[model samples]
Target: MFTSRTFKINKICEYLLNAKVKRCYPKHILSNRSVHDVIDVDINGVKLIFPNVWLRDNCQCEQCFHVTAKSRIIDYNNFNVDTKPVKVTKNSNSLQVTWDDGHKSKYGFNWLKLRSFSPKYQKKYNDDIYRSPKIVWHGKDFYEICKKHDYKDIVSSDEALHKWLNDTSVYGVSVIEKTPNSETAIDEIVKTVGFTKRTHYGEKFVVQNVTNTSNVAYLSSSLQIHTDLPYYEYCPGVNMLHFLVQTKGEGGENILSDGHYTAKYIKDNFPEDFKLLTNVQVEWSDVGEEAGNKFYKLYRAPIIEIDSNDEINRINFSIPQRGSHFPGSIEDVVPWYKALKLFFNLNKKFAAKFKTPEGNILVFDNIRLLHGRNKYEDSENNVRKLIGAYIDWDEIYSRLRCVKVKLNLID
Candidate 1:
């Protein structure tokens, strides 16, 4: 019984009364060129601005999106960058749009807010999606908080397994107590979290004094602190070393130092050295025969690797495996050596020296922690034996996510 003008006025009044109106602009009425480029909608005191092109490209219709894959199916070849909405309507919980091409799209208020380009929303999304942050630790302090999970509990209880994985993710090291003294023990423990990563040494390798050893770990001599497999482009992640036979002699203790912690120390005290290590690439190579197969592996990477966020992502330093091929300018030799020496010295200074008990599994992030062993005598009666295996971070993180979901730790 009312005119079109009266109805439009009444609708605006109702919207103003019910909603906390900020800025709701329809594309058709926007004469300002800049305003026409985006669609702004305010819901629940939050304003989300969506570019016209983004909105069209991200259409959630069945034809434009794949529901199961949760991905866009829109063909970019035919996509119009200048596409504009002919009409926009705000409902109770969503914003509805009719495109110029007669394509209809609807976006939930929450979804739009989450995909906002604002820094706050971007940070929130990253925090919610990324893995848990690493907690860097020093020697004595880390040793005090280092968790030891019983092997049986980890195998049987989901809660226990989650706790153990979380501890390893945060602290980069953990111990599994009461692990059976057998080669299969390492297999059992790794299966709980993920599958064993096969390398040139196979799925598992023995660590004991041998007649002709291809690796330094097989020798009874003192091993300087180093991460394993620096020569590989994609190195192994988690390492599980099970003590089957404990050395009865002195100087057989294991040494562990947090590489991330050491890197941070250098960054704070010697920023130039830290920059050099992070920027200069060095060749890490290995040429040997293992398990009856001869191979030569080489990789070049900075001693310290940082991610896009400039956060420490990896530390690759292996003196024995380092190739003599210096690809850098001749002037960088002494400075590079000085930085390398500082890193090695700090690793030794901050290392935790301890003898892992027999039947205990020493699990650690191979990429984050440098591990070594002291000199030991390997006689008939006091022979030291250990079984070592590697698992990738992909499997570990996937397992952690599954456990977290099962435990309702995350959605």
Candidate 2:
């Protein structure tokens, strides 16, 4: 036997110890359907406890794992990533498992944990904030929902504006209403939020062309749909476009598109093109600023940024302002050009647009949502001008995500 009363941890030689697989409360089980987990076990010589949703991950089912079933097999990507340990209680019969997708299931902890002898999870769990980054769940409908919320309010409070800001990061867009149609108030509204930070963003002219107050009204015309600060090495992390004057033209609409979505749309539809963008890091530059010093930069980032939950986080795209391309060190330039062409076409495909009135503000998660204008011509001398600013994505995301359905949903 391993021990007389209980198994001695060490010191005895394995040959003399005569140890056996008395019981295993491992973490995961591999099966054709998918991997499952265990929380408790009643076997001897072993103990295990499933971590709270912290250890589980989104199911790589057909819905999420759009790849082949063979490729879909649980790989290193499927395990929990934190570094804390979860204990399995010996003599415990049943175990509970909460998945990353907010799913709950129970399995005989022995069944799943035993099958999961592999490095199932690496999450570090403790009742402290110091544990790896706090896992914040941002949903897919965040953008679409926030767009709807923008139209319902007349004047959102300071607290309300911040909540909307956070929603912008989580959903990639947010809206504030009830902004007075005055230049001073609009400027003050954005300034109240303070400038969000980044090594490369917001230090230069954060509010794009704000000093040129003369053309503010004429510029609000349906502006071309394009990303902000694509030329900079570090693009504006977040952008705030506050509209003080909304009623000059009938349909002075603001359009937006999630570059992440467009990139995916092209990737799944046009594989060859998608490969070009992802394979090579495109370079962008900005110059010829008649007013200030020309802004120029070249940075490297994937066009489509998807997070751990398979959700698009940011879209690094600015085709019109694009400069030379840097296909991978080994990659050829042909694919790079091909992907750029495809991205431009797809970006033009399913962009979103919204109309704003006075007292309305549109906060864009510049990393993900690209903004543009339709076409506005001051038939008369009347013009459309908006006061805007740029803030970091982190600030915006924190405020809105906590607003779980309790805040008024503008529907």
lDDT tens digits, residue span 302-384, model 2: 66655676555556766555566553664456666667667765665666656766676777667767667676544445556
Off by over 4 Å in 2: 1-144, 147-163, 184-194, 197-223, 289-294, 306-312, 325-332, 398-411
lDDT against the true structure, each candidate: 0.83, 0.50
User: What are the models' TM-scores?
Assistant: 0.84, 0.55
